[model samples]
Target: MPPLVKLVLIVVIVIAAVVIWGRVMGRRDPDREIVGLTDAVRAKVSREISAGHKINAIKIYREATGAPLADAKRAVDHWFVPGQGPGVRDAAASYTAGRLTDEGRARISELILAGRREDAMALYAEATGAGSAEAQAIIRTWDTSQHY
Candidate 1:
């Protein structure tokens, strides 16, 4: 065998080993790891949740736990709030009371699908009399994905 052929063989073997190692390590139970998180991180996330900053709490939980996005969101939703169980605010609950109509929601979904997120936010805020921050937060909770 030529020298270059031996080198290529070595590289391929090393790449395969690394990929296999990664697959095994990635199989660790995320639920267990999240359950075993430190008290300090739990306290920080709790404070963020208590303040009604759900998005911030999710980001902090993700950064600290290194959990997948869905896992982080689920964990955040499980945190207890003052008056709610697991603190999971429904997407509909994010909207301003008596302001967001069913037709308005459909229009916003359409705008979002058309890649007009900013316009959608503006329209939501205008229609609902919500602040910019409130509108953006509500928008983040919307299920914008279209399914057949």
Candidate 2:
């Protein structure tokens, strides 16, 4: 076989191995991701909560674990104790749960109309602290006709 052919065959094998590995790793295992959360992420979540940015906290948690907003909220609500660090306080409990409000959806639509789907998803996730999957769902279901 020619050198070029050997190179092509090697590339194909590498790509196939990567795809197979990704598929096997993509299987749902909520506990697996959560358990893998680094202490730095936990500390950041704690700091965000203390700063009265509960939505941000959930966003960080969701990004780190791919967990749903509800799970992230619950984890933040239960894990960190107040007064141990910056922005920690009892008032953190008063923060509302993350959800894409009507206004948020509208803003995302506007972003999409601007041909910024990635920005739209990022803004939606930041504003609502939704998981990546949920944010994608919102983008997928957006009524494009409304943009016209």
Candidate 3:
């Protein structure tokens, strides 16, 4: 075999091995590793969820620990259950109150700015616990000056 061909084959093999290893590791219980995360990190994750970025929160968790999407999602979901953590409690309160956190509002604003009114309305509905009609009304009459 040519030297260049052998080099390429070796690189490919190494890459494949790394990918397989990552997949195997990512399938393990991510919660066990993430459970002891500091309050600050948990707070950030909570804020991301409250802001209607649950997937992003999961991605953040995964990036922090290279966990699989499923595992990361499971960990983040656990963070929302009552008694899991103080940050979770605050996030739950904000969610139950039908209030949008600053991050949520900003995301909505971005959607609006991008001419994505429907997406913004959907996000508002999810974040504020509003029905379809109510969500439309709120979006139409949204007062940026008022606290959400």
Candidate 4:
């Protein structure tokens, strides 16, 4: 075969290969990406239970999206407190629960179940401000129990 003919054939083959690859990949829609069944169900559940504030909304959103860390402090800080929001109590509960490892969940549970909602909420606020993970954990656990 002539050298020019050989070169042209090679170019054509390369072009054809490129075209075929593009066709196969092009058929895939980026927007059609799928979430797992569990995630989808969780998202649906979260949507069913929306919050009034952006923070709680985000917590629900992150929970649905399977966020790695709850970062209750971020959520609490961002949450809108009307005179005081639930974050206050949540923070207090978190603080009490975190500091008193000896007291354990039972003490925090007692605080939460104490029927003194305002006091518990205040304690939570203090604890959250102090950046206490224990407090956040307590709130998270409490919220989970209530939700579940």
- Index of the highest-TM-score prediction: 1
Kindly report the root-mean-square deviation of model 4 from the true structure over all alpha carbons: 13.2
Candidate 4 weakest ten by summed lDDT:
139-148
The number of the candidate with the highest lDDT is: 1
- Between candidates 1 and 3, the one scoring higher on lDDT is 1
The TM-score of predicted model 3 comes to 0.35
TM-score of 1: 0.41
Residue 71 lDDT in candidate 2: 74
Question: What are the Cα lDDT values of the candidates?
Answer: 0.68, 0.64, 0.65, 0.45
Off by over 4 Å in 2: 1-35, 82-148
Better candidate number, 3 or 4, judged by lDDT: 3
Candidate 3 at residue 31, lDDT? 53
Error of 3 at 28 (Å): 14
Clashes of 3: 0
Tens digit per residue, CA lDDT, model 4, 1-148:
9999999999999999999897555433455433432523433333333333545545454444433234433543453322233433333344455643433434445666666544554465453453443344334334323321
* Model 3: how far residue 130 lies from native, Å: 24
Off by over 4 Å in 1: 1-24, 28-91, 94-96, 145-148
- Across residues 26-98, which tens digit of lDDT does each residue of candidate 1 receive? 5445565454455456656766776789899897787676666778799898775422434333334544465
RMSD values for the candidates in order, in angstroms, are: 13.6, 16.5, 14.7, 13.2
For each candidate, what TM-score against the reference? 0.41, 0.33, 0.35, 0.23
Q: Taking the tens digit of each residue's C-alpha lDDT, what string does model 2 give over 56-140?
A: 9888887788776667789877754444434322312222443545576678778877889888878866875655655554554
Better of 1 and 4 by TM-score: 1
Using lDDT as the yardstick, the better of models 2 and 4 is 2
Model 2: pairs clashing at backbone N, Cα or C within 3 Å: 50-87
